[model samples]
Target: MAAEAQGRAPDRGEGRPLRWRRRRSLGLTLLALGLMLLAGWGAFTVSVQRRTEQLRAESNHQLDLFAAAVQGMVRRLEPMPATVQLSTEVQALLRQPGDAARVQAASSYLRRLNAHLGGMQLFVQDQRGIVLAASDPALVGDDLSFRPYFLEALSGRVGRHFAIGVRDGVPGYYVSHPIHDGAKVVGVAVLKIGLEPVDEAWGMLGAPALLADSNQVVILSSRPEWTYTALAELPLERKVDLQVTRLYGDHRITRFPLQVDLRVDEDSQIVEGVLPAGLGASGAQGRSAASRGMLVLGRTLDGTDWRLLMFADLRPVRQQAAQDSLLAGVSAGFVLLLMLLVNQRRRIVQQKLQLNAELEEKVTARTQALSETNARLRKEVREREQAEHTLREAQDELVHAGKMAALGQLATGITHELTQPLGAIRTLSGNAVAFMQRGQLDAVSGNLAIMARLAEQMGAIIEPLKGFARKSKAQPQAARLATAVHNALFLYHQRIRNEQVTVHDATADSPLAAWCDPNRLEQVLINLIGNALDAMREQPQRALWIDAAAQDGRVALRVRDQGPGLDPALRDRVFEPFFSTKSAGGGLGLGLAISRDIAREAGGELEADNHPDGGACFTLWLPPVPHDAVP
Candidate 1:
């Protein structure tokens, strides 16, 4: 019958609280999930863009180096053909092409030079383009009349051409200079140098690098398969010329397959890599490795028709960028989530305040109704009286709870404080007992007196707690602030000793005079010191320093602790009542708020901030009294 009378839904008092809790939980969960998704999405896009830019810059730098290498190689090898024509060995061989001894000696000398220098097959050819004494003895009788370099040299000018060797179908650069026999051009001296050495040098760089001719043919390539390939389709005229000269031998002018991913600049670009047709068709998975992304940069060599190119794998850079951006975004999102939590907590507190106000209004109305019904019904008056008693008891419980919080901190220190004096009394009493047994009357009396003093010291320690518990609304007086500091240290002496905490009195030289109740001030200091001890529980070294200084015509009493400083984000809320960083049952966070109120009543202020060196500094600024009014 009672459940039916109450209706289908639970009471407002019971179900409302549960409903609010559920709402809060749902909101927080949704917010956290949203943060993660937003962070991931934002991270991925931003990371890709930044990674691309960085790789582009790196590719450009590599391109500069590549171009410089080709230009430097050209400068080094360009003069060799003309310079070798003037070589004494070459001149002797050219002066007497029919001399067998001179021919052998010249070919041997050319072979040694070609081996030491970074070039392939340094040789000599006659005016008719016939292979004369050569670096390779097998090429001595090879025909070269079909080549353009020899024809150009016979016209009394230095000539250069890239063509296949007339002796073998192997491609090489042909450079020729006409030999002068006393001011008349008699024959042409030619140098045939292969590009294999340049290709080998490019391979050692650990990147895909290549050199291409004016016709866009990949003449020298670090990757063997890429050689003889063209970057783009060749025109008919160039193709026909290459075919006639047989520059690339029997190899087809195939195009290197690449898919452009992005263009970094005119000289540098990015591409996606995959196995080429032949490699893929042959099922050579390991042989032809796939690249995620490759950066390629190209530049033309100065004074030459060749272009230098560099390619690098950019997969690692992109991956790192992704990781870095995700970490940054997640960190930012976490900070934002914390801010949301704090804002929600603020709203919850405001809601609690509103509920309290509404409850108070309802109670007032209920009291008025009970008062009016008392005359009509005496039975209800007793019930109303019981309700008042219950309300008073609830108020008392709240006060008791506040006192318990302070007492919990004092409890540990009290135990440690009494231990030392109690031990001393025991020792002295034991000595007295021993002396009495030996019939030493004077020594027994002396030990008894010492025990009495120890007992009195223990009483002195217990006396303050009684006064602290019975706090009074006492008015401020002109008292020396240093006295309160000393009392705090004295009360916490046992805790300090037990915890191995070092205490410093920076204001011992100059006493701090302030207008405040000494007992109340001492309680505040004890509270701070106890809190410091708890904070430094995890610290290896514990220390506390009390500093006093004059600031803005007021005496500031600062308590500093060598413990982890107050969190910057939570510093503003530290003085709020019932706000605590400690775990459940540790504290109610009422101490600092109460202390601040007491300071205001005593014409003082309390402020907290992080110290310059480390830890937290709680400064109690009081109205300064003259030295004459120190008491």
Candidate 2:
């Protein structure tokens, strides 16, 4: 009957009896496969949940160990400065200023103290507001009468922390203690330490570290590249609320109490929850290599309205669980098939062959589609690379144009600078012409001499412009750093005087030289000094200082002003092209960017930092010219 049915199927162009049996076998196989898949999924879910818990626990322990190690190091270093400040010998020097022996002894002690503290800057000031001595000799005679520390110590205050003077040429904190002469205030001892150590310590803690006041004004951060000092300047309430919300969402902690709430009148409660483990719907949309399963831990810093967070990937544990479930599902399917093999072996073998043929056809179609997609992707990549190159060239052109525009604006000032000599030359020529017309030979000779002197004066003004106009590829020259600074100052002297900005060149008398393009170095100076003047435009205390020195085989020049310092948020971006905060039409914002490029081309660099007392300082550092390279 089976053969008869098969023959009829072939006659009707339907199929054979074997084909029908294969189809029936395939239906049973599919049902069993579905059951096995469901079982595997169920097992995977439970295993993943348990493994996630384990990973969370392990990650929390690791974070705890990391935090402990960092805290220990910080605590150990903290006491060293306090110990030095409280030394009996340091107190003796503060009480007796005229005792040279004692002052010298204290100075030596202070130097040793600073060295022990890993090169921290230290200061000792008398109660009378006089800087009695310093670890650095340059600061020995500096008056601290206006400093907050001196004033506080004179009032008999105990140890206090304050922010003062830019340390290491950067803004930082000062921990100070009052020196007592019996019951009366005698003087104050202060320690200046860089925040870099704190930042490094935080890195060792396995997370980014930040120090903020109760108000959340990021006073210091280990990740300054990401966080700005302006964060501290924001309204305390806004900073606290926003940061608290983010912290809760990122960490899975259930409950937290806000400490040192500077914003609200009362403390606030915080709660955090963890989402379920799965292939997150939102996560799957992205192309990131990161897995879905993760655990987050968080805790609030004691004595501050700040939170610390840690995150760990749980993908490895989840993957192992999934693999185990897959193996179990395959094993169960094989066992079921074995039990059915006796009755359905022939049918099952035919079904397997038919299924294999369909799968192969689908794979071939998918491969062709993938090849087309890959070709399209390659074409898009090529187009993007071309677009990027074009954009870069356009940016370079814009920068070059902006520089030219700035130079053009300076033309008026340059002309004004030259007018004095030009006017004298005209007068001398007129006199010479009149003498020659009157046939007064001797008088013409005198005028000609005068003309010569005036010609030389005109050359002085033109010389700078000529140097500035020269467009040669950067070449190393044995140039005097001090001379370059002075020349740059001379070009801007009129503007500085008009703006009532004071110029103080603390460069040494002896020439400090470097291997650099003289014109380019001067251009950098011009840009920095000009910016310093502009910064003080609205300030009553307008002062500019151009200080230079040679240190560690480099020539360092610092241009500082009493103007409002750079907004911390904009500091890092200041050197990026066309990133201007100045009013429209005020500048194209290429000055600093170009200056930095020029510095780099000269084998140097430019850096900016906030002054401790509140100002901006731009520093240019260039390698000292090798004696052998000198022309």
Candidate 3:
């Protein structure tokens, strides 16, 4: 019995070593599997982060396009409201709202203008906010005194607002401009543009977007149900204000079911939401990807207290990340199993040696490649510098040549101007001498006076030529833009008169100033005006319009000609050096090129485009100088 006990004890001790080894092996396998799981989670997190950023960038780009379209529409309509100031009927109606004849005339005029403007409703309201006349007969006599836009215009300002129409139960964007009787505001002219077109356009873009006002109420949306819904919770005060203003009319404003599950950043978020019935897609079956979840991005509209929000579907991004995570986990498991089955220690050592050797070889090869690339880059940089220097020298020569060409072109007109004055002076002097000989004192004095006036006239014609021919140092400072426009016109007076062109000068109506060299500004204006005149040379009813206005910290002067508009394909190439549409020997085509350079030197830009009405328009934009700074 004692011997059997001793044999069992030795056997048990032997089995202890096997058990210990088994347990150790099991622990290592578990650790590897755990690490693999962690790696999978890490991959998933990283992928989600990357994909979210990509989605954000894409949404931002789309937002920019949408914002641009919105702003363009508003800008197109904004000018329409101000055009009412030019209507005599509108002016007459405002002066005497009680006059039935004037009211009918204004209404008829507005109706015609509205038809021409694609059905935008136009109305004129008196100082008392009583609608005297409107393109839509039903809108007349409507009391709009309580409206914010009316109050804004009455305070002598341009008013812009978006609201639901009280009469028609439709949404519209209103633009109002004051009718000024000298310095006093007499009445308001308003244009109401339907938002359905904008909404429809947005819907066609596929991506979901909404436009929210300052109170966080959606005014315009690609989704109809989203309109009038609050993007966030509206405070009591805001709700009261909306009710009082009746901005959204009788529409019940409620909080949208948007829950922010994650805040990506200040301008981005992951939200779960569904739009209202009117804004949501009708007859939709189950929960769509947008309804399930979406990424939201927001941007403030330019020049307005409104925000544009875009929604991007997030399902694809999440699905892709999940698939990548699963693949990573499976790959890790497969690699782990192979390593365990092979003599893990030996295989790991071999892989480490091989990896280190390959790394060293790759490092050496990359160093050589980078060194060669660096040398090539340095050579290319030198070549580029030389090329730029040569181009600059050539540009300078071209500028000089352009100035000479302009002088040559003006020579004909200058000669005609000078000859007339010279001939008159000669005749007057001869007559003065004849009168002196006859001893008619009073007649001789009159002849001498006339001769002196003729001599001064000749000097006036010669002075501009001398000033224009002589190059002046570039010194950008405060200068009157209106003055530059007038000076350019003075240079083209002879050509303008010869062609019988009707000139409309709006710049003379206001004091506009810009930061630019007076000589360079005049030169640019002269080039623009010359181009306009050339464009109108063959046109029967020639006319030119020059307008200047200060906007967004810049002064813009536009020269428009009544001629065949520029060809679309040629518009972009118009400023290219040596590019021209002129007849042979008519111009060197360096005028616009040199003018553009001068504009840039003075921190401005020159733009060319075909006006919407009819003609080529050249606009020069310069940094504005404050009214007080104008010397």
Candidate 4:
């Protein structure tokens, strides 16, 4: 445009300006025509997207309301089964589960409830899972053990299940309540509900809808013929199970006629991808290909796996979209006409303006641009000052981090140096005491030889840290039960004799074994034996017994002492951390707590109970290694 104007300005001098004006008018007309077309296309695209979103939202809302109505109707009937279970006659009948005469009266009452409650089949089952009485007399004495509702109620819980009925061969939803004889579950009271009424109500609505169970079978639907249809293909195992149960009688499980896209979830995309051509011409109640494209919205019913599905016809939506496109096109055309008329009038006015007027407009625009550039330069200077201040603060943080790193290094060196010697001293001292009790003076002197190095340990704090750390890569293997018990006694032999404790070992001669960490198991025995010695300090008998035996594919090690038994109120809380009965300063109250954790980590249990004869008994149960699995 600049080259063209420059050439024309020199050729025309200042006399012939009409040709330049005509050229400008032609360029503006073509530009406006292209813009009008682009605007029309954009309007159509936006209208289609908006319509799709509105349809999706509207369908979802309708499905949600339908699901709520269905769930509410079922919930209103929940109280009936609970109320029937509380009747004295029902309870007495269930208590005498074998009495056929007693069930007759119950069956009569159930029949009356069915008549009054608008087509609900009520029944009762005994603990043996046999239907003792039912609203339908023929169902009495039938076995319903395989039903989920019966199984759940027999386990002492309220049961809710939706299944095709095995006994009556009809699809129904079941709700059951357990009938308790004192604290024991005696029988279950069940109510089988037919949702034909909900289906009928849905039929009156404009759109088609259905309610499907977890197995994807339509139990209630707006279209009556659609009932018992499966939404998706069934696995081989599930199909066989249903067939054996005869849940739907002779009706074969088959897929619904509607096709769905697995790649996308939105209703618009799913409807757009349906292939009616695959189902052939006589598919889905004889609906044509265009009519078969349906927008589907599904919602799961609360507290159950059942789903409510709503389908909208895509043909009507497409027709509405077409109308919207035509309206946008007409509007775009009107805008273009208005613009053309305004531009034509402006063209006439511009032709009358002098050349000096155009020069002045250009000068005004250049001045405004220079002022904006100056304002931006000032903002940059302010930003640079703030950045320098931030850099100084970061330098101070770096210095503080350096000091912390040096301090951490010093602490690590101190801890590693101190703990090594303390562990050696503790081990040597235990071995020395064991040798002395055996009357081996030479071995005791040999252990004393380590005393020169033990003094180097000095005094340091031991911290029981509970934080992230590298885990040991040890695997549990079978270990001797007798070895762990004797190790604990050997370590504390001198203390036992000094306290005047008479210790008896039942596992000393017996060959018993367990699957656990040997070191951890010994630690558990030591804590228990030490606690027993302290408990029996004031007792006259002063007896401690260690018993170990194998039973029920496991090893049981028990430690009993003739001391004050555990308090009945504290039995449940004895294994809790820092809950020792010992006086303050007697111990840190962590011995039993730590021992319990060790036993559990080795796949064993540590339990404390009061012995019947009069002392506290602590038992450790460990898993046993199979004879063939021994390494």
Write down the lDDT of every candidate, Cα atoms only. 0.71, 0.64, 0.77, 0.72
User: 1-631 in candidate 3: lDDT tens per residue?
Assistant: 9999988998999999999999999998898889789878988998988997898777777777777788776657777878887899988777777899999999999999988886458898989999999999999999988788899999988888887777887778888999987888888988888766667678544677788877878888776766787866788887788888898999899765453332334343222222322233223421353354567677676666677777777777778888889888888888888878787778777887879988788889999999999999999999999999999999999999998887785674356336545655666677678988888889888877766755665565444444434533366788887787876686566668878999999988567788877766776787788888889988988999999887778888889999998999889999886688999877767678767777776778999999999999988889887566665
CA-RMSD of model 3: 25.2
How would the candidate models be sorted by lDDT, starting from the highest?
3, 4, 1, 2
Report how far residue 624 has shifted in candidate 4, in Å: 99
lDDT of 4 by residue, 406-525 (tens): 556445534533443455567778888999999998988977875543452233112211100112322467778788788678656666777788888998887788887665576578
lDDT of 1 by residue, 305-418 (tens): 676666666666668767876787688678877888899899977887879988788879999998878766887777889999999999999999998987775665456446
Question: Which of candidates 3 and 4 reaches a greater TM-score?
Answer: 3
Model 3, residue pairs in steric clash: 224-278, 224-279, 225-278, 225-279, 226-279
Q: List, residue by residue over 203-266, the lDDT tens digit for candidate 2.
A: 5545434454333334444544323333224555755553543311222211111111122213
Question: Would you estimate the TM-scores of all the predictions?
Answer: 0.44, 0.34, 0.50, 0.45
Better of 1 and 3 by lDDT: 3
What is the alpha-carbon lDDT of model 4 when measured against the actual structure?
A: 0.72
Residue pairs in clash, model 4: none
List ranges where model 4 is wrong by over 4 Å. Answer: 1-37, 166-168, 261-282, 285-293, 341-631
Count of clashes in candidate 2:
1
Q: Each candidate: how many clashes?
A: 0, 1, 5, 0
